[model samples]
Structure formats: structure tokens, C-alpha cells
Target: MQSIKLRIGINHCLTDNNDLRYNGETLSDGFVQHTLWKYANWIPVCLEIETDHIHQTLGCQSEHINDLSKKYLDGFILTSNSPRHDSFRPKVGLSKGGTSASNDMGVFARSLSLKYPALPIEENDRLHDPLIRENFLERIFTSKRWNIAFSNSFTPHALIQFHSSHKFLFMSHSVSLYQEMGRLVARSGLLTLTELKDRYVVLMSSSLKQMATPNKHTNVMQHIMGFLKGLIDADEKKEIVETIDQYRTGQVPWIVPITLLNLHLRKNSAADWVLNQTYLNPYPAELMLRNIV
Candidate 1:
């Protein structure tokens, strides 16, 4: 089956190729690479423009904040100099040449998290890192899966099976989340499917966020490969070690080892269950997301 195309909400400036700073110029075409532009559907959101227009009608920023909550967005990638908290609340910048926090895109990075706790949000700055980009794409895909799964004829067994398939990812990325999922799975009989799914999605989003952070990078590769250490031959083992070293040195993308491991796993019938996992190959292989070095 093919992966669903995600609807990604992006900052207006990033989309329009404009820079919102006082004397800033236009953004380069390479701001967002062609691979991402071609892969996902981007919806530009000028929260500031909407804010400026609605400010007079609503008469208060708090009401505008409430209004922003109503927009339908799967995930948001905010550009730099974008308003933090979606409000130019503080006079951090001036119209002419002075600085403004509202105009500072970096300040607005985490605003979406506070506003929508379950929403997957990222900054354009962080996407330059392949690992972070991979994590962001993974989260949106999982978010869409969660949305579709819950909005359909979901059953308790399905939730359990879903948890089972994705449990390896949590185990590899976040042990605490792996344990939390285990505990939640145990309560499947007692809890409603909706309740369980809600809790599971929240934890899943949290786990993706946790793994995306820099601190978890070293352990993620180690954890996944650790499982395959005994299953592969000496040559495969050597390749994995070299791949991991290359990844550590930034000589290759983080996915090189994963792609290599996936290839190795595919050859062994004993690896069918692990190979069948959704998170292990979440995105379409056609995207070539894993193929690049």
C-alpha cells in the first residue's frame, strides 16, 4: 500500500519566498528542497496577516489566539522571523529597522507545541538535519495514520495489533514510551478503544518528539542495530559498524545504516515479523528517503 500524502501547514513567508524582517530580502529558492516540496502538500498560513485583519474585528489578541485553534492543520513547519505564539504581542521589532520578537522566526518555533499539544511542529532551521527531517516526516505520517485509524471502524484488537507493530520503534527510540505502551496495551480489555487510541496517539507523538531531539540520536542507531547483531554474518556486521561510524562522523545520512539493516533483515525468514513493522518502513521507499547516503 502507498503512504498517504500529508497536508503540512507552513509559515507564509516560507511559502511566498519573502523575508519579513525590517530590511530583509526574499528567501532563496533552496529554502525548502524539491524532495519535500514534491513529497507533501504545503498549506501556507500567514497567522500575522490573519491576526492583523482580525485584531480590529476581535478587539483583542486573546480572542485571536482562540480563533487560531480552530484551523485544520496536520502539522506545522514555521520559518524564522515568524511570530512566536502567533502573536506580535511584544514590540520585539519596529516597522523600520529595529528588532522584534514577533518578527523573529526562531522565537516562534515552540509556540505551536504549547497551543496544540498533540500537533507535530518543527522549525525550518532544524529540517537541515537529516535525522530531524526524517523524524518530522515520520511523525506526520504516523499522525495521519492515527487520524485515519481512529476515524474509521476501529476495534480493540486492531489497536492492540497496531501497538504491537509499532512497539519496536518505541523500544528503539524511547524505552520509557515502550514501557508506557506496554502498560496501555495491558488495559485494552478494560478501556474503550477510543480512550486507548487517544492515549496511544499522544504517547506516540511524544515519543517521536523525544527521538527527534539531538540527545537521543546516538542511542537510536545503537538500539536498532543491537537487535540485528547476532542475526547477520561477519561482512554484514563490518558494514554496519562502518556505516555507524560514517553516520557518527556525518559522512552519511542517519538512514544509511537503517537501509542496510533493512536489506539484511529482508533476506532472513526469521526476520519477517520485524520487517513487517510499520514504523520500520513508515514512508514509501519510492521517496528515496532512506536510499540517500
Candidate 2:
């Protein structure tokens, strides 16, 4: 059972008040629901600024960002033309930064990314790309795992345990990073927990940025399937292999092959390690991240 609430902050500068009413796409809602599974409830936090109240109590750009981040864990920002004024505009090169207009609406999008570098941020425009969307969700789920695993303690044992669970996930992304992460964890006795965490997270995120291709995923999936070589008969093993091959060819979704492996896991106790490997179930089944790619 899960108790913590999962949140994704949405920061956007609305050109009109109608944007505040509703845009009417429940994909975000469903995505959260599926990713969190049924273990916990969902409370979606969104910040829409139609006008920047630089003089207003909550309209200050810094406060607006602080307040929004306080409520949500991660977020998306929508880009649009916004009226620019000196009061809220930076004297420095605002346009040169690749940020939008000088107004709060335009600039806050860039602020969110800068403020939360570890956050999985996607712009309203770029998120339309399948690859970008998948990457965002994958990073968000990784952030979720970090939140859960590191919430309580950062002892050496805890670090090792967390690393153990995620090794396969790292391997699927980058075997080199996997080995490097393991080496760092092995040195927990020599380094402070804080240092260990900081270094490990940077490397973890870097590795995941490599993008999990079909071949990489198939390799991890098969590696997991291999654990039960003798337990499953020729026919059953062949079925799983063919299913994974189909996924490699893009004939079926990742969920199909993974679910098949899970069934085998349930049938055999010898494959207990497969259950702990994050590669098998990194996020909730409902997310269907595997379904698309």
C-alpha cells in the first residue's frame, strides 16, 4: 500500500481567463492515476497566471514560483506570447536565455526548469513528441522512486538496498552506469551518505538520459526471463521469447512482454530476484508507458 500523494505541478501563463476554466484533456489525470496505481489518491496542482500581479500579494515572480513548487512535485509549462514590462523584466539578457517574453507568464516557464533542474519538466509544445513524453514520465517515475526510497534514511545499508532494486533498471539504460553506480554504492563506507546520494543521483539521471531503446529493453527483459530457464518448459519459454521479439520489432507494447515475464515469476520462486528488480515494475501498470514504446 502507498500513502504518499504523487503531484506534478503545471505552470502556465494563460492569455485569457477561459484557460483557467478548463482545457478538458484528462490525460494528465489518468496518467497520474495509472502511475500511482490504486494504492494512493491523486491531487493535481496547477498554476495558471492570466496576469502577473507584481504589485499583488501572490503575483511576485519569485513568490509565484516558490508557492507553486511548494504544492507540486514536478510540472509542465505552457509557452505563449505575454505582455512585457520593466517592473517584472530582467535588466539582463532575458531573451538570450532562451526564455520567452519578459513578462511573468513567459519567463516563469524557464524559471520552473531552472529552479528545479532535477524535475522532469516538459514544455506544452515539446511534450507532444512521443519520445519526449516517454522520457518525462520515466524521469518522473524515477523521481518518485527516489522520494520513496530516500524519504526515511540514507544509511549505507539503505543505499545498497535501493541500489540493488534498481540495478536492472540502470542496466537496461546503461550497463556502464550500472557498474559505476554499484562501485559508488560499494564505497558508502568511505563516503558520507549525503555525498553518496548526490553523486549517485547525478549519475543515475545521466544514465537514464541515454534513452531505453527496444534492443536494450529486450536485453533486460530476456535477462530476467533467463532466471527461470529450467523451471519453465520449452513451449512456455519460447512463448515469452517470441513475445519479447515481437516487442523488439514494435509489433506489441512493452507491457505485453513484461506481463508475460511476471506470470513466469509468479509460477517460480527461484526467480525471486526478478521481483525486486526495478526493470520488471518501475512504475504502475496503469501508466502504460510500456504500451506506447
Candidate 3:
């Protein structure tokens, strides 16, 4: 269990009482409101509603970047406001003339990335998916652990050991990149701690992006299947193929195959590092996050 509740920044447009959304309808996802809310401390952020006292009182604020630093938030959720109604007279800017870029969520997200280069950031819509949400939840906890425990000070071998322990997760996205990262970790040989941190951050960000989108996530799962082919027997390979087929046909959730892989890996005596990963079982088993499929 987490000793501290994660502080996450959410887009204010999703919660404000005022009719700020372009669709003039409530934007609600029950999982976020009920499940995630129970586990996290949410801080609302809105640049457009900077002056709305009512919204401010509700916890929405304009200066989120500074607040993020001060509070040491664990993650961020960027919800889209779409285009405001014509009556609202929305601000326009791609380069400051109320351009698209100025009003874009990417602008704010990019700023967050630049300032807190290792923060776990995700768009709101992606969190609607159970798989993506579970992955994000794991990342939030893992990142907080890294920041609080190992970021500032560590022994000479701590960073390398940490990287090696997380190699299973690093394999979740690109096999080539994962291999290259392992090579870099080996070659660095106890120096370049800052560079290793930056690489780890990039790995987290890239893996999240890949798994959040359906097509990309499909590719990711396929890659995982490919990687496991040589390691598992013919029977296990067939089972994996069937599980992936079910996933593609909407018969099962995505976590089924991943859990399967984890199970297989755990049986290998040489794979003790896989046993050390708590992220695989991040939430209580009763939550059925992995069993939903």
C-alpha cells in the first residue's frame, strides 16, 4: 500500500461548474471520480480560468507549474476543453495571436515536461481505458518511489541495479531501445548518473505513450509476443497467441497476456529480478486489475 496519497494535477475544464466546455455537456468518467479519487489528491489547473474566484475556491488555480514544484506532485492529467462556444469568444493563438499552439494542451504539458523533466504526465481521455489507467497508476507509484528514494542520493551501484530490476518494464515498449539502454548502462559503469536519470525518464515517457494509444498498444503487445517466442515452449507460445487473439477480438482485456508473461518469467530461476518488481502487482489482487481480461 502507498504510504502517501499521490498528488496529481488535472485540467480544470473537466470539473469547473461554469459552461466552459465546447459541447455544453458534463465530462465525466466514473473510474476517475470514484476509484482514482479515492487514491489520489487531485489539484485542478486552468490557464483560462485564472481569474475565476469561484473556480479558485474549488481548488482550481492558474499557477500550476509553480504549485507542482512546491507540492512535489507525482503525476499530471491533461484534459481537453475543446473549443468554447462562439458566445464565449475563445482565445486564439498558435504563436500568441490566440493561435492554436497557445491554446493547446500540449503547450502546458510541454512546459510541465520541461520544468519537471521526469514527471509522469498523461492526457485525461487515455485514462478511461482500464489497461492504460492501470499502467499509469503503476507509473505514478513507481515514479514517486524513484523520486523520493533514489533521485538525489544513491550508492555507486544503486542506479544500475535499479535499471536492471526494471528491465522487464523497459522491454514493454521497444526492444531495440531497451537493448541499447542496457548497453549504455553497462558501458557507463557507475558514472553519468545524470545521463542515466534522463534516459530513464525518457523510457518512462515513451513506454506510456506507446501503451496509451490502441494501435500503438497493439504493436507493443505484438512485440512482447515476439520477444517471448524464443523463451517459451510451443505450448506456451500457442497460449500466448490465443490470449492475444482474444484481446484483439475484444474478448479479453490487455493485461491477461502481460500477466501470463510475468508468470512465465517468474518460473525461471535465472529471472530473480522479475520477482523483485512490485510494479507488476501494484494494486491489491482483489482489485482484479490484471484479471479483468
Candidate 4:
């Protein structure tokens, strides 16, 4: 029932639509921006810090990047637009006011990249490319998924539920890994909880590397259709099949079929299991990540 909240440190990622207020009806304080959502529960310590807090401590203005480590955050986002941040590499900094300066975004970026090479440290410009943005979202969301689902509970039952919810999404990534994950979850009692969790993490990391292709997505859509058997009328089934076929043939994006599935479930109130699958609402529909993927 908990939403994945990402603690992204954005220097200047905001545009005209920065603050789309959520009426707090959900659970916590958060806002939606374009297609992105920022939750208060994202980072462990965002609640403790004041909204007006400048994050400047002592002489280091680039200190916010380090905040991830201190607060046990899953990841960080450095979406800056300045030339200095854009032109910076791991060790290189601008020449003027040399010595890496006191409070330069470039220096901060360099530090973040060099120190946390494995973390999701991205810039806004590079993310303009569709492919790059897709990859970034995958990595960030996958990492977030691990933290949210498995981080709290490592029992066999918990693992099984986690795998069940992400079943279709995993199939879209790699059918092979999807099968392997099911096997691991099924055999969870055979191994220690820690071992199972470790193996699942390793597989999850590798499984999502390859982008979901049309064929794989078609496989999931087909599988979900099986769940709706006898529930949909003949014409409704044909319409759904046609939409899936369109997505498979690349005539339309996955959004079309996905939206259709959501509507069907909403109107008919299918099985609870079907409705609970994260595949139907992996992230926010506003994100449109699937639309581009």
C-alpha cells in the first residue's frame, strides 16, 4: 500500500509546473510535476529537514549530494542546467577560481559521480534523449522497487507476494529471468532469507538492463488476457486483442493496450489479484514512461 518515493536532489530541474499539490488524501505530503511525483516519505529524513532549509553547511554548497549517504537515501538526482554542471567530469573542474571552487555545481557533480559511480546521478540535458531518459527511469525505479518491497521484509511469503505483483513487469524485462525469479521465490524455504534476497537483487539488476521489447510486452498482455477469460464479451475481447496486436506491431505504444486493460478492470471489477498487479499501474500514468518505451 506504500508508494515509492524518490529523494531526488534537483538543483534546477523545476520548470513552470514545479508544484502540483496533492490534497494529502493519499497519506503523506507530496506533489506531482508534469509526469513525476515527489513524496515526503521518499528519503528517510526529508521529514526532519525544514522546507526552507538552504542545505548549505559550512563552506560546502555542494553538500546536498552527500545528504543521500547521511540520510540512508536510495538514490539522488542532480538535474542541473548550468554549463558548469554540464561540462563537468569526475575530476575536472572549471579553470576560473580554480581548486574546484567553494560551491560549484560542477564540483558537486564531479564528486557525486566519482564517489557514487553506481548511483543514479543524471543531468537534465542528457535525459532529453528518449533512450537515456528511459534507461534512467528503469534504473531509478528498479532500485526504488527493491528498496520499497524487499528492504522491509525478507521472508519467503513476502518474497512471493513481491514477485507476484511484479510478475508481468518482470516478464516484459526478460522471460528467462522472470522464470528464474519465480523459481527462486518458490524455493525460498530452501535457502536462507538473506541468500534469497541477495540472489534476487543480483538477478533483478541484470534482468532490467535490456529494455522491454514489443514481443516481450505482447507476451505479458497475452498472459493477462488469459486472466480475463469468460469475463469479456466477444467484441470486447477482439478489441483488446487488436490493441495488443497494434502495440506488438509497433503501430501504437503500450499505453493504448495498458489503458484498455485498466478500463476493463475498472468497469468490471476483475479478480483482486488482477487489479493489484503493479503492471497495471507500475508508476504514474502521467509519467508516460511506457508511452515512450
Top of the candidates by TM-score: 2
Which of candidates 1 and 3 is the stronger one according to TM-score?
1
lDDT (0-100) at residue 285 of candidate 2?
A: 63
lDDT agreement of model 1 with the native: 0.63
Off by over 4 Å in 4: 1-4, 9-67, 78-123, 131-135, 150-152
Q: Residue by residue across 1-293, what tens digits does model 1's lDDT show? A: 35456677776666665545323455433536456666566776544444345444333434534555665456777654444433312325555566443443233444445567788877776677666777777777777666566555777777777777776666556879878888987888888877987787778777777754322444555655666766888888888888877876767775776777777767654355677777568777665655443
The worst-scoring run of ten residues by lDDT in candidate 2 lies at 80-89
What Cα-based lDDT does every candidate model obtain?
0.63, 0.64, 0.60, 0.64
lDDT of 2 by residue, 19-101 (tens): 44223322232333243334333332344333544234335557756776655463343432222211122333347667764
Clashing pairs in 2: 9-74
The true-versus-predicted C-alpha distance at residue 180 of model 4, in Å, is 1.9
* By lDDT: ranked, best first: 2, 4, 1, 3
Query: What's every prediction's RMSD, in angstroms?
Result: 5.7, 6.3, 6.6, 8.7
Separate clash counts for every candidate: 10, 1, 8, 0
lDDT of 4 by residue, 178-253 (tens): 8988888888888987899888866765676657778988888889888778888999999999999998888988
Considering only N, C-alpha and C atoms within 3 Å, which residue pairs clash in candidate 1? 80-105, 81-104, 81-105, 82-105, 92-99, 92-100, 92-101, 93-99, 93-100, 253-293
